[model samples]
Target: MNLPSLRATERFANQMILDACRGAKRVHIVDYGILYGDQWPSLIKALSERAEGPPLLKITGIDFPSLVNLEKTGNRLVDYAKSCGMHLEFHSIATAAWESAQPRYHLFSELLFVNCQLRMRHIREDGIIDSPRKLFLEKILSFKPVMFFQSVVHADIGSPFFIHRFDGAWRSFLARLESFEETMKLELIDQSQLDFMDKFIEKCAMGAIACDGQNRVERISSYKTWDRLARKGQFGQLPVSKRALEMVMSVWSGHENFTYGMDENWLLLGWKDVVLNALSVWEPIEKLPRFKHQ
Candidate 1:
């Protein structure tokens, strides 16, 4: 099933990334939580079809060490780029924590973009000087990417109290399940596929409720919280372009239950009344010196 919110996020993100890299000779993308590398194939195709010819592309995918085989993911992306006749390089960084992962900065030249999708919340947000999320954001800012795009599930499911967290998770899960059910009803789906989706959602619900302390993975925060965090980190929010907004609207044009809107500079996607996800773009607050790779 094509999840409307996910598809909309991908479409909006790719459009922005393409626009940022237009006319650049070399482009580097640092992707956080690049599971399966599903978002890059369409981007590679778009680059290949560029009128001025595709730029040399380099992607550095960062994720937990045990979560995925980085080498395999890199190979798959490399092979896909080759098929498109685009020169590409893929680097994989596997670390226990995002704050500790150090990417090769010397390789970045010309255009640099960072893509963080539904993953930052996984970094422990304990109120401490060594907060992983803060350090991670600082690291990204240090890279001085032209544009930093973040898509996060906006839910108050990361509260410290179990009862509050459980209540938030339950409500968010129900909303997501309802949206999935409505979508499935519109599309002709077989029982086997239905069973698979059921399992998938159930697993996510269990993870959100039963786990805690480093073990709990789905630590989602509200968009307001993210907004404060980004501003506190000395990043300036960028407005979503008119074309990008229209493109996202077209993705959900036929789905009456789906809704889209903007909160400040962030673009939001929702199912009915419950806001599910948010996409925000940012750049460094102070201009930094640009260095090309030697």
Candidate 2:
């Protein structure tokens, strides 16, 4: 997500962390799927800018080794921390699933935060938790985070909840793509830019649509389902205030294209109104392996 889209998320996350850490000297945040490091600068800057913030902000990033360059990303974060006057220590653990990986306890503090964004869907793509996904969540909750900041692209195609709305959503995405294409044509965009847009349309816009015989299903579930999984794993949603929601939506309110909607407890965002289904995958309950919260 872009910085504007994530402004409210960062605020909510920082508030939760501060509230949870109340009297703590330090805060430890565990970030899952730290892809290319676009998500952190704003959050880190916000926390450091907080006058009442903890003395130390330690973040542990977890992802597959082959997918991320740990040392390189860690160095970039360390540099930002140093400039911001926060005692920043970053540790990168190479693991595909948290269930199988181990995080050194010495890095943790009294307050723990788990950050997951747009990446958990892959874990439930098969409609089952299987072993790794369950274990991954189980291990994180083992740290007993004060709050888990999870931002899934909600698109619950599994339920009739969005049955009637799917068409509108599809149209919106298509319109956005068409508008962009027209703009490109007007500007006579280069071949590379055209290529990028093609990829975005294929992977993002089109990939979100689920029809018969299509392998790319919108695996995102509703907030209710997520609540069930969170409850199973021993975490709960952070209650967000009305003002906060408005503030988050305020940035996009005047925008002509992008749309946002609310359902159950999920606040959905997209290029248009096509969020009838959750964008992430769901896990099948019957197939979930027994996991007693650690």
Candidate 3:
């Protein structure tokens, strides 16, 4: 099974809520697509362990009805809650967001990571899921917590970022929430935060070494800026995760611009910005496993 994300929207949101659990009697978590609900247990553990608390904890996990691993994921969520001494309940929707969407609140931890959404790009207008997410928040603004953590993608491999272009579907989704009369304090993720997978960086360095003794090293970038390989010591000294960037770069080659270099979180609809960031890959890692080669 894949490990949960330390940098995921869920985990990040929890981090923001680690404090200020006062008056919070319950927590709500919405997994629009509950892929095994695998992240919930760890998140619960983190919440249970991270901050000092009072007032019993109640966690409600809501998911799409058709998930195959619903039973397993729900069981894990329950077990984790019991072990952590938190109250737990599970709810599911037989329909999809496409079919219909209902505002959901699942848990009440000190950490608040609400605007968790998949992203997409539209040419005529911008598509920001957070826009609708704000609506969701407006509905719950009365219970206003301290911090809200959100993660969104600014770049992707193709013309549309939604894994495919979304036809104002996001705007339509957000429109559903706009009827709320109030709004909550909001913040967006800056560009510098999520730039690379440690593994992707390592792969880049590996590819550099594999490139040859004389190949010219062009640029190195993570999620932000791109720079050229410094010297003989640069790639060789980078950690395996850093070198893994080479593979991600290779993958970027297929993209209009390596979004990783352009700062993986930058809005990608502009014409002027093409190449993302440059990841310096030519170094060597000692005894590191090699990523797939091109």
Which pairs in model 1 have colliding backbones?
A: none
Model 3: per-residue Cα lDDT at residue 234? 24
Greater TM-score among 1 and 3 belongs to 1
Candidate 3's C-alpha runs over 4 A off are: 1-8, 20-23, 50-55, 60-62, 69-71, 103-149, 156-294
Top model number, TM-score: 1
* lDDT of each candidate versus the true structure: 0.82, 0.58, 0.34
Q: Can you write out model 3's per-residue Cα lDDT over 72-178, one digit (the tens) per residue?
A: 76777778788987766665544423213454542233222232322111111123443332333333233232332223322222222332223322332222122
Q: Compose the digit string of candidate 2's lDDT tens values, residues 1-294.
A: 233444545554555554445445666778787756666776677667666664576778887777779778888988987788777888888775556666555323335667776566545334355655566677766665556677764544433334543653456446546545654655568778867876775665444454423354434454456666766876544455565565566654544655666655556666554542221211222221212211
Lowest-scoring 10 consecutive residues by lDDT in candidate 3?
178-187
Q: Please identify model 1 stretches exceeding 4 Å from their true place.
A: 289-294
lDDT score for candidate 2 against the true structure? 0.58
lDDT of 3 at 83: 92
After the best TM-score superposition of candidate 2, give how far the Cα of residue 193 lies from its true spot, in angstroms.
Answer: 5.0
Which structure among the candidates has the greatest lDDT? 1
Off by over 4 Å in 2: 1-12, 18-23, 52-54, 106-109, 124-129, 157-197, 204-224, 270-272, 276-294
